[model samples]
Target: MTITTREDEERLRLLESVILNTTDGVLIAENDHNQDSKIVFVNEAFIKMSGYNKEEIIGLSPIGFFAPDASSDELAKLKDAIDKCEPCNIVVKTSKKNGTKYWVNVSVAPVSDGSGGFKHWVYIQRDVNNRRRHLQALEEQNKKLKEIAWIQSHVVRAPLARIMGLVDLLSEHHDSEELSNNQIIEAIASSANELDNIIRKIVQNTENVQNQSSL
Candidate 1:
């Protein structure tokens, strides 16, 4: 029995240490109006991320870290979700103690005691600024590609079709023209040659674009 008790104590200590030292920010808050939703627990990672020591924040409202001009409606919605014991995820701009604002992906879930009473609220926060910037860049590139595809399909193709149709018309009336109309025939032949050159250039340009896209 003595050995068993010692082992159990060791296990609990290890679990607490792991939670406190984890790299991801973790916080626990109570849902009471008098407490002003004060933080009940915060891991070391949360301290580092928020630039707040445990002593400074343990009994203070976490919402104070949010920007002063932040939307109250959004805060109300978050509070309502917590009140209903529902889990929710939201992107919020939070300010550090130094007043620098940054975007965070925050997930909140209710913690309940085994007896069905509300215990605390758990929050997980991750910085998402880099991920958001990367997604924005990808959206811009996709928009440009769509524009290029439209130009190729409609703008470039229309003129090429007209040139090809003129060549076909010349071929069909080849026998009806007089041999003495050499100059007119030469002009028609030169126009056809120019059209062929333009089509080749368009094809090369399209190929270059496709290769760049593949890269």
Candidate 2:
């Protein structure tokens, strides 16, 4: 009996240590099905991540941590999952106590009572601000590259087509009295100049995008 008690005590201590020392933020809240659930427990990681004291967090609603512009649809889906006693995982924009907004990956699951009803819910969240920022930067670069491709394919082709058509017309009508070589040459020069200007503008736009990204 004494050995069994000691082993149980050791296991409890190990479990507590693991929960308190884990890197991911952990929280437990009552699963109030009809109302907003209040936070009851938070781990050390959650306290540090949200920059909130235990007293300030204990009775707060988990929804209070979301950013003002956080998607309503996502919140609705999360609530639906909780109501159904299902696990949910979502990436959301969240805020700290200091009003600084960042991104997080949040997971929630129901903790059921033995009788059948869910007594509580557990939350696991991790800061994903760096990854989100990196992806945004890549998206911006891709947008700029797409614009460059459009200019190359459509804008550049317009002036080149005009120049080619003028050259062909001049060549075919050289003996005819309808058109003069100088006029055709002048038209070609103007189209070439237009193409040159378009190229310069594209280069400038590209350089601007690159410089902004570097910053």
Say which candidate scores most in lDDT.
2
Model 1 worst lDDT run, 10 consecutive residues: 175-184
RMSD values for the candidates in order, in angstroms, are 5.2, 2.9
Off by over 4 Å in 1: 1-5, 33-35, 52-56, 64-77, 97-100, 174-215
Model 1: lDDT equals: 0.72
Predicted model with the maximum TM-score: 2
TM-score of 1: 0.69
Instruction: Say what the RMSD of model 1 is.
Output: 5.2
Which residue pairs in candidate 2 collide? none
Candidate 2 lDDT over 1-215, as tens digits, reads 69999999999999989879998899888855556788899999998998989998897777655536468887887878876889999888887888888788999888879898787888999999999998999899999999999999999999999999888887786745665788789889999999999999999999988897897
- What local lDDT score does residue 52 receive in model 2, on the 0 to 100 scale? 83
